[model samples]
Target: MIPPAALAIHLSIGQVYAFSVFNLPLSQIIGVTVSAPADWKLTTIGWIFSIAIVFLGLSAAVFGKWLERVGPRKAMFVAALCFSGGFFVSALGVHLHQIWIVYLGYGVLGGIGLGIGYISPVSTLIKWFPDRPGMATGMAIMGFGGGAMIGSPLAVALLDYFSSPISVGVSETFLVMGAIYFSLLMFGVVTVRIPPEGWKPENFVPSSKPGKLITSNHVDADTALKTPQFWLLWVILCVNVTAGIGVLGQASPMIQEMFEGVITAEAAAGFVGLLSLFNLIGRFFWSSLSDKIGRKTVYAIYFGLGLLMYALIPSLGRLDTAILFVIGFGIIMSMYGGGFATIPAYLRDLFGTYQVGAIHGRLLTAWSTAGILGPVLVNYIREIQINAGVDKAEAYTVTMYIMAGLLLIGLVCNYLVKEVDAKHQLFKEKKREGL
Candidate 1:
């Protein structure tokens, strides 16, 4: 039941990842009958998603401790309101043809909902399933990936249903989606519960040694930031995300250009949807694998294997092999999702469960940074290449290599990861708190 509630919240917030479905439609929205001189450029519309992500990181960092204090129930309800309201506000922006209004609504306000909703269920889930923290966090975060699976297709279908010469159907689709998400999220708010203090699963026994890496200490969120371990993990996450998100943001166009007539626009959308499925599955598969191997080892696989796959992408594109291309990119997407799902448990191993949620919140600033860095790097480079008379098929070649380099850097950071220092450990602090 708890997992389901967490899933409900995450599934809705995950819709943000599918924002690209609107990129083409929104760009051409100003003129229903023909091209509008005032139409928004794709690059201009791209910032809306970036702004929301930036805010997602900001709100999570600023309000993470507040979420810990208030508990998931209250935090979740507020998230529901803000997230749903963003849709309505964005609809109005679409109707009026004002991009700034859309930015304010979806980017700033919707982003706040994303931050709160994302972390809301995480801490509670960890507390409920202490024996399998990796598996527990994986389940909730998997919904985020899965949400994109559902959202991308749903958005495409809705646009088809309501589209006409006079309108692209964005306004109506936003209204409908807003209402539907609010109802589903309210179900989560109603169903979620906190575990009683000292609660643990029945028949669960504490690990005898729990290893030197897994501590019996409790670090506050503030104190966690002062430690080097946190910053190392921050670098690890930032680079990992940068390697994947740019590929994801531009997946639709990249595929179309690479394969040209071999893959249609609709087929490209399905391809995006397929990647979501891989992303969703990888969150569960790799995170569960982490339980058998150590989290550090699992991340080592993500960075190392990820580096090779990224380097191979340019060659695969050059060969124009659709089947092999899909398989390769699919594996990369899995590791990308795996990186997100595994990190919370990795944090638990190093920092202990105390303030893990708040710590996780602060750590998400890496995501905000990557959110801007990834797309801008990919898109900007591709644009420069295109303007310089490079073929669209070859434009992404340099971008893929750059992404591979980012993953190599991540491998170094992961290799450097070690247990928190004793001075930073909070065993004494836990005793003071009477725990």
Candidate 2:
């Protein structure tokens, strides 16, 4: 059996979740390179996040079947290599002052790592913890959310020690981070394995299927895609992701500008780091809570509370960073992290574990889409402000309002989610809700 510690390690090192931490510095580096009569917009840099997500989602969709065929450990090893290697190569790009190289290493190569690593621990965790699929997936996946909390502060320190005006100090930072992540991930690879068969959690049985005839058999990705549940869930994931990412994409500038009175630009880095902490904590706390609260209800809270939080941001003054940062950024980060955790269970609920690994691959298209929408919206709105001569804080207030609207729509989607096979009430008939 895979050691639980190994499973946690496998999931923790995936860079897709933690990559947002690089947005600010990466953007600044790119901004520095722009020449006279040329400009770099916030949206331009935001593309790094979008490109990485797009590639991550795309790789997941393309590689799902292969991953299923090969197994998570082998795939995750590749993930570690690519993720770490990408960072190393990216460090080179930064040192040479080559933006395209940075994009190639960080966006393309790292994206491949992100996609593979993303689904790495999921199936193994589900197989090992059959009785508590949501909790299991959450535990493994929560690491993604937490990575930035660890990565950002660490990256900041590295940059501080190595930073130069001409060169961002991104190289040394990448070298250290790449080494650490690779070593940790290798340890996870050595320890990961599948649980023994027929090993259901004591007294565990899955809920019944709702419709056309739920069977205890596995379904392939193509067949799984035909179900309404698949498409509906695609919508659900897209909306959820869109809501959180808009805020997260611009978190640093937003906070500094929002509370400029109390919080200054220099302090903004720490506050941004703090947002990551909330992001990380929310992943573990909310995902664990979903074990008791039910995925649906937890998401309901994610959206319901999220709407209020986004609405309050612009009005929240810099009176107390402790108060505003905790309340305002906390809900936003949870939604970001929760989207990663809750969706796996949502997929299991609709598609069954038959070919869930593959179906999840397909479903990640939603992430690709959200990646574009979220960063684009943030950057586009900010671009309008920069052109109109608006300051950065004032720039994002409009985006926040738009995100609130999107969350409300996501709230509707959550509301629309009746039990998957509602008409048939398949859950009523079956005892084992196949993890």
In terms of TM-score, which candidate is strongest? Answer: 1
Model 2, residue 405: distance off in Å is 2.0
Tens digit per residue, CA lDDT, model 1, 340-377: 99999898889877678899999999998988789889
- Total residue pair clashes for candidate 2: 13
lDDT of 2: 0.71
Q: What local lDDT does model 2 show for residue 171? A: 74
Query: What is the lDDT, from 0 to 100, of the residue 14 in candidate 2?
Result: 47
Candidate with best lDDT: 1
- Residue 302, model 2: lDDT of 82
lDDT of 2 by residue, 1-435 (tens): 454544445444544555655655665664544432233345555665566777788888988877777887898888888888878888898677676777788788888888888887787776776667777787777677666556656777887887676655667888888898888788778778876644687777756643332234445577667666677678878877887777676766777676767667777767666666676667667777766667678878888888888787777643555476557777688677877787876666555564567778889999889877887888888898779998765777777788888878877777776544443233323424532
* Alpha-carbon lDDT, every model: 0.89, 0.71
Score residue 47 of candidate 2 by CA lDDT.
Answer: 60
Q: Predicted candidate 2: what Cα RMSD to the true structure? A: 5.2
lDDT of 1 at 139: 93
